[model samples]
Target: MAIVNATDQTFVTETSTGVTLVDFWAPWCGPCRMIAPVLEEVDQEMGDKVKIVKVNVDENQETASKYGVMSIPTLLVFKDGNVVDKTVGFQPKEALVQLLQQHV
Candidate 1:
């Protein structure tokens, strides 16, 4: 599954109905680069069980600011449109999967 691009316009609705994992990242963020593959792996492994979305902080500053994303590679897990879990920096694929599983 391809990672969905979540912007300020789509976030509320997209995340509201399902288990959505939103990655708040910037183009220049090294940690975000490191987690890119992990997210892709999760997308494939979890398939439709979860929705993975990427938000480019550079292009979508309003959404990023709304979420109070203070650092790069911030992972926010939303269930039923409400944020339930949050992690900052790079995380291993297993750790991320576990995090997602908790909400799933």
Candidate 2:
């Protein structure tokens, strides 16, 4: 499936059961914008190997704060309802692939 969008209210349910990569970002973030296409590429290449989602920090402050997202472009990798790995800042597709490989 294509990358999904999640909110504070639906974060848990969407990320509950499988390997999910949650992008914590705001529209105004430059690096966040740069990583968008990379994430799309990963989603297309990885396919069912992973579920990708983006959470806009501006609108999902509660979830963002809950995850202690101190910066834009923070990534949280969730598996079976827990955060298994995390990375900060804009990352290349290879780095993202590495993260998924380590967890998924």
Worst 10 residues of 2 by lDDT: 44-53
What's each prediction's TM-score? 0.96, 0.97
The residue ranges of model 1 lying beyond 4 angstroms of the native Cα positions read none
Global lDDT of each candidate = 0.92, 0.94
In the range 49-98, model 1's lDDT, one tens digit per residue, is 99998999998999899889999899999999899999999999999999
Which residue pairs does candidate 1 place in steric collision? none
- Per-model C-alpha RMSD: 0.8, 0.6
Clash list (residue pairs), candidate 2: none
Per residue, candidate 2 scores C-alpha lDDT tens digits across 1-104 of: 89999998899998998899999999999999999999999999886889998999999999999999999899999998899999999899999998898887
TM-score, cand. 1 vs. native: 0.96
lDDT of 1 at 48: 80
Residue 48 CA error for candidate 2 (Å)? 0.7
Q: Which stretches of candidate 2 lie over 4 Å from their true place?
A: none
